[model samples]
Target: MTTQKKVSRQVTLELEAGNAAMVDIGKMLGPTGVNTRQLKLDYDEATAPQRGEIVPVVVTVFEDRSYALRYKTPPTAHLIRKAVGLEKGAGRPGSQTVAKLSREQLREIAERKLPDLNTDDVEAAMRQIAGTARSMGVLVAD
Candidate 1:
């Protein structure tokens, strides 16, 4: 049986899906002695389907310089803005309402975010996401 390599370090980065800049990758992984070029190609290929979203990636570098990557879904704010068709959140969250989102839409977003969320209960997840929406001046409709 093959044994897993010892992890040398771990780095987390948020990159544009499928279009991460080589310069950014080199800047982050170069100091670690990891192969930045290979990492960029692999990341771009794996995230191709999520081209327009931002994807959070965790890179685990092994002692031998090999690495593994784990990808997380886009940020809640991004997802919320996409659902509401907005380019950005309100300038003043509580005072200015920018858009509205239905409960169904909330549930869908919660489900999508379940894997990265702290709670297992969908209801709790919905509540957490709703809080984020509220902070962004997005009203959650009944």
Candidate 2:
């Protein structure tokens, strides 16, 4: 019997500084539409917390020798609100604000959107779907 396995692996690029060296790296990634300026901006944001820690960048390298970098900020407030069904802001957020989804909101969305779920209960389904959304980095609100 032949065993099938997952084919791809995740890779990361760890840089010591915010964007001090991205110019050199940009020359390498330019052809692939990996904007050097954007990369630097993302690098700065990721490193904003530590201000001194090494920023680890996870990138997806396709077989074509071109790669896509995964460096970005969290979803904006408007995004989270839309995901949760609020038209505007909820409670105050910290410097890096994170929007929230109440249990009610979670249940409502899951009940409406998910077609594959066999269960009929909205609350249970919502909780399950919320977990899925969180893992996928989807901002329904945004």
- What lDDT score belongs to each candidate, Candidate 1 first? 0.94, 0.52
Clashing pairs in 2: 79-142, 82-141, 83-141
lDDT tens digits, residue span 90-112, model 2: 24333323445656566565655
lDDT of 2 at 112: 53
TM-score of every model versus the real structure: 0.94, 0.32
Which residue runs of candidate 2 sit more than 4 Å off their true CA positions?
1-11, 17-20, 61-142
Top TM-score hit? 1
Best by lDDT: 1
Poorest 10 consecutive residues by lDDT, candidate 2: 71-80
Query: Could you tell me the lDDT of residue 31 within candidate 2?
Result: 59
